[model samples]
Target: MPEPIRTFRHFRDVPDSAWRWGNFSPAEIACRGTGQLKLHPEALDKLQALRDRLGKPLIVRSAYRSPEHNRAVGGAKASKHMDGTAFDIAMANHDPAAFEATARAVGFLGFGYYPRSGFMHIDLGPARTWGERFPVRAVPFALEVPAARETLAESRTMKGAGAAGVATVGAAGVEVAQGVLAEAQGAVLPLIPYLDSLRWIFIALALAGIAVAIWARVDDWRRGMQ
Candidate 1:
């Protein structure tokens, strides 16, 4: 049988002094950049516990998000942030794995490691994990343009030189053309290795996206199971 969904009152009852993390405040966690913050009691409790265990300041990148704000940021349809049960914390000073471990020990069920963006997401939602610790650098397609242009110019020069003097151009022009072709090839050949690397990077990114989607589905299933 499917378990009943847990409901939370959308309000903040805890006093300011209750939040041990002096650096973080309810105002910063509020939706739409407003000072009015509403958070699930358990979420706040676990977060504070995690902060205390770490013995360091935790920078909250994002917390409670309004439905409109969530949509604008392309958040998941049933994002925990909407219910103030999620937090995206900066990973600058904190070690990702250590922070994640502390968060889990403090009862956060959802974990997302985004080393590229320098932030980790923790939430009191269905137990799930996603995202990459090492980010893939995108291949700049612009680099290829210059190499292609040089190749084209070399080909055009070869053609014009050959037509201008078939006699003198026959031997000397053929030699020069071959040299230009070699130069162009030299310019283009190096990019092949780089292009191959980019192909793998693109494939990896696609696979990562698919993995995240599958993870979300599994998390939803787990929620149902609960």
Candidate 2:
């Protein structure tokens, strides 16, 4: 016997994404309705709180799912959404990062900000998040070269050139490469400060342990001499 999913009547207006909804399998529906989703009641509370705090509907673009629904949407195999602990939401024409910040302030877990997708993914499980905001630029195709004129006069340097009229062109090629590199560095920057703090903390702990060991040895020697 378990508690039912705490559903807010106001949230009924929110859209349900691709889930089987009323057609969900018995087992799946039971899982979502139970306390197995630890934050079943809390999810409803936070959803309403977000709506009030943001002064918008804060539409739920997706919600609890069955395994079949999960497979159809290409969801991660271990998604919390299936258990009624996760929800995807979007505010009409709102910046996802700003909206996600709002969600984080409310102490909701799993706020994934996907700006391009125009929505944020949230869950009531672990306090963690991950999602890309911007578009992904791919390597550009090379430009074609015009035929070289063999009969035209050329400079000495032109004669020895490896290829004729095949020089690289346009800012796009350079821009895409830099964009990817910058994205990678931006991703790593968040971890660096935490890592530095840990390094200093580990060193301090090591020194403290060494001092304690020396004091213990000194006490042992004194007791033996007594």
Candidate 3:
């Protein structure tokens, strides 16, 4: 037996458990002008099945219009929307031909193409089609690359560069100190050898950091080319 059509004054009146379709909400199918909702379970079932098959969002433009809202919107006298069995879906994220094929497979018998408005209407009424087909797109919308989350602290090249910069500054400061200490303080003469050793260590660290930075740059370039 066919599921009986149900009506609600507002989408909020719908019980949470009664809303079984995972991809659709009662609010989405409510009358745009009045907030009233009429539900046809089999129609929604077909719609949900279509959504599941497409594996993408179905952007509903209009659905479940109240009789008054339908008339105000200049809908056909016997529009399926008043019966809660029609939906106007945006085509911005869909390829019309593929979408139509899938809609048919999911038991949507009515199709009204509004290419100028960028939406297509599908219904569970008698089989029919209307209006111009969408112009062929060179490509459907492509998924974007995920964002990178690497921070400066996590970059090995940056770490090496920081180490090198700190070492270079430390070595220069030590040299200046040695010059002043040697000329003014004969008591601290033994510290000069240790300071000389530290200067060489800093120079070595700076060179090592430069090598790491060069390696990192090359690796980045190679990966980008790939």
Candidate 4:
């Protein structure tokens, strides 16, 4: 015998525009740049419970992706986004561990931590977890590297000109070089102390940006292993 489809009685009386969880509006939980939404009643109920427990505003970073959108964003084949049972929340004002615990207590089982992206993924899917802690936000090191190198090069050129001892030009060049070097050092000085700790993260981000195709393949392989 076929099982009867269970219907949520509360959702029947509520309009889509009025559908909301605590601290989250229907518009906020909809897909980015689209009005489409398909939030599961149970998921919303659980999330509302979580919000009540936390007593803070929750920002929905992503929710209810279409299958095409999911694939475009490299979501898993069976991702909960397609069914509207998943959402990603911003971590700006919430403690990750506490948030995860609250979500778990409220019935979310799927978890994914994207420290590099400064967000966490939660879903009402089968019990499982993935990803690592994001202790700090990913630095814009790629952008900074070129600027630092350019400054260093300019300082070197100024120093070389000053060393040539060309009277007025030499004295002026020396002064300019000292100022440039000082400024450049000031910009890069803070990064030096944490170089060892951030080395792997920097390398990984660099490789991912430089070789997208390779990174995609490697990422797929890595996810498969997990």
Better of 1 and 3 by TM-score: 3
The candidate, 2 or 3, that scores higher on TM-score is: 3
Model 4 C-alpha lDDT per residue in residues 1-226, reported as the tens digit of each score: 5222222223233375556464677666665544566657777777788889988778889877766777887889998877777989888877787788899999999999998788899998799999997664344222223323335445434444433334434345445555555578577656544543344444444444445545545675786699
Whole-model lDDT values for every prediction: 0.67, 0.56, 0.91, 0.67
Tell me the tens digit of each residue's lDDT in model 3 across 49-103. Answer: 9999999999999999988999999999999999999999999889998899999
Model 1 per-residue lDDT at 122? 91
Per-residue C-alpha lDDT of model 2 across residues 19-108, encoded as one tens digit per residue? 223322223223233312222645655666766776645556666766776787788999988766777776454555556677778767
| Candidate 3 accuracy as TM-score | 0.68
Q: Runs in model 3 with CA error above 4 Å? A: 143-226
The number of the candidate with the highest TM-score is 3
Look at candidate 4 and tell me the lDDT of residue 226: 90
RMSD of each candidate relative to the true structure: 22.7, 30.7, 7.4, 21.1
lDDT, model 4, position 43: 77
The C-alpha local distance difference test score for the whole of candidate 1 amounts to 0.67
> Candidate 3 has which clashing residue pairs, if any?
none
How would you encode candidate 1's per-residue C-alpha lDDT over 108-140 as one tens digit per residue?
Answer: 999888887889999986999898763433532
**Model 4 CA lDDT for position 157:** 41
